[model samples]
Target: MLRFQDWQENQREVFFPDTVAFKWQMIETFIDGEEYDRSHVITESKWLAEHVKQGEIGAQEEYKHYKFNFSGNGQIEVISNGFTVKM
Candidate 1:
């Protein structure tokens, strides 16, 4: 998962590295009350040309699947779309 400070923060265009073999995008949807909810989905742009290439960090399916380290208190919550998704 990607860490976004706010729903709007995820709305801009992004890219996978030249090495990755897929496409992905992050988006947000506004539901009932006031907040917004965000989601990331893999968009098909390319697939790794070779099976062995998949293991390299550069060969992940999509840019979004790349890992990033997050550090914080054990309880973290996202407030959005008038709902909260706890992590």
Candidate 2:
């Protein structure tokens, strides 16, 4: 199993830099096998890029940073300020 920190580092060094270089309007996530909407949470691609560059695998809003948990089975759990969304 890969640790979250290690995954974060890999994201920062490779995945984000190579894949997430475009602008986005929203981010979707899943938690406990259920989808959750978070379109209102993140609206700027620059902000998201900044976090990604900073070795973060999640989003941020209102000065709070959300974290993410990546499952090896092509799934990701987004831990937001109020809820967890897995995708």
| lDDT (C-alpha) at residue 37 in model 2 | 22
lDDT of 1 by residue, 1-87 (tens): 223444344433323324333323343322244223323222221232333255543443333322111222111222111222333
* lDDT per residue as tens, model 2, 50-85: 766676544333332233333332333222334332
Q: Give residue 87's lDDT in candidate 2 (0 to 100).
A: 22
C-alpha lDDT of candidate 1 relative to the true structure: 0.29
Clashing pairs in 2: 29-86, 30-85, 30-86, 30-87, 31-85, 31-86
Q: Which stretches of candidate 2 lie over 4 Å from their true place?
A: 1-39, 58-87
Going through the candidates in the order shown, the clash numbers are 2, 6
